[model samples]
Target: MAKILVVDDEAHIRELIRLYLVDEGFEVIEKANGEDALAYAENQSVDLAIIDIMMPKLDGWDLCKELRELDEMPILMVTSKGEAQDKIKGFKLGTDDYLVKPFDPVELVLRVKALLKRYRIDASSLIKLGSIMLDRRTYQVIYKDGNQVTIPMKEFELLYKLGSYTNQLFTRDHLIEQIWGMDYEGDERTVDVHIKRLRERFAEFESDFKIVTIRGLGYRLEVYRD
Candidate 1:
């Protein structure tokens, strides 16, 4: 069973999440404050974390930052503030998803399951193409020359998709669906932007592969043979 850490200051809120999560066959670990949650996360193997922003001691934002540094598991932020800035802040802090207060229990469970599914999809945690080593666990890329490059979430997913299948063409719409999701409102140009960013980042190191653009089709990873 997957272990989930539930952090909230209110007893009822914690209990409510526990009931829903437990029903979904997940093992829930409850914490009353961010301090306890952070400590527990440090010492235990947690698959996912459901954090409330208005907790005592360490706030959700700080706690999320700390936990992200410690683990690569998915994190979902729960907050009463529904403002766009607040959600952006949570995303900037490395939260995978966000939930508003008064959310449906069923929706919460579904979101949690989806996150777990996404994280567990990769059979190999580390994928190597040419001289580039992509660590799926931490999303860090290491070059053969010992230089480490950090990639953003979307860019990293795009690179992983292409790198995992060297020389396979991926259409713009296909990449959009795979990385940005089916509900993405952005145009195909979003793929172009991410691809550009990936190319620039890879250029910083002496990489043996390059992301090639296919005219009128999409892109692929081209690896140079030794």
Candidate 2:
């Protein structure tokens, strides 16, 4: 059973979420504040976390950042704020997904399941997208014809991260924080430059996978499957 940590300031809201999650066969740990939730996660094993943004002590934003720094567990942020900027901020903070208040419990469950699946796919060191194989251990890309190419470290890391979760959108800020260190004082265009090189390097492998530019957003890796 997957153990889920649910943090919210409201008692009734926590109970509602817990009831639905428990019914879906998930083991839930409910915390009324972010402080308690962070303490529990430090010592115990938690598969995922559901956080409310308006908590009293340590709001959801800070909690999400702290949790992400600790580990790679998927985080689902719940808040009444449905603004685009709020969502972007949450993504930048490393929250895997977001849900608005008064959301259907069924939709919440589905998002949780999808996030778990996506993370499971990303946890592998070796990701095979069609005939292109990314080996993180060696930082190499292997082609279908048994040809292997070792690219620049940053380019390889960027490619591997995208290929890990095909079709999942990643913001530029989020990518920078993940690939480069959080303290990186470089331009976001650095990601664009690396992405351009990856695209040029793998131009011949378009049939295998393509790094898609999501215009105002960022990017996602689309793998063509037979």
Alpha carbon lDDT of each predicted model = 0.86, 0.89
lDDT score, residue 152, model 1?
Answer: 91
TM-score of 2: 0.52
lDDT (10s digit) by residue, model 1, range 40-95? 99999888999999888999999999998998989999989556678888877779
Please, what is the TM-score per model?
A: 0.53, 0.52
Worst 10 residues of 1 by lDDT: 121-130
Candidate 1 matches the true fold with a TM-score of: 0.53
lDDT of 2 by residue, 1-226 (tens): 4789999999998999999989987889999999999999999978899999988989888999999988889999998854667788888787888888888999999998898888873332568988888888679988779888899999999988998789999999999999998999999999999999999998987988899999999999999973
In model 1, where do residues sit more than 4 Å from their true spots?
A: 121-226
44, model 1: CA deviation in Å?
0.8
lDDT of 2: 0.89
Q: Candidate 2, 72: how far from true, in Å?
A: 0.4
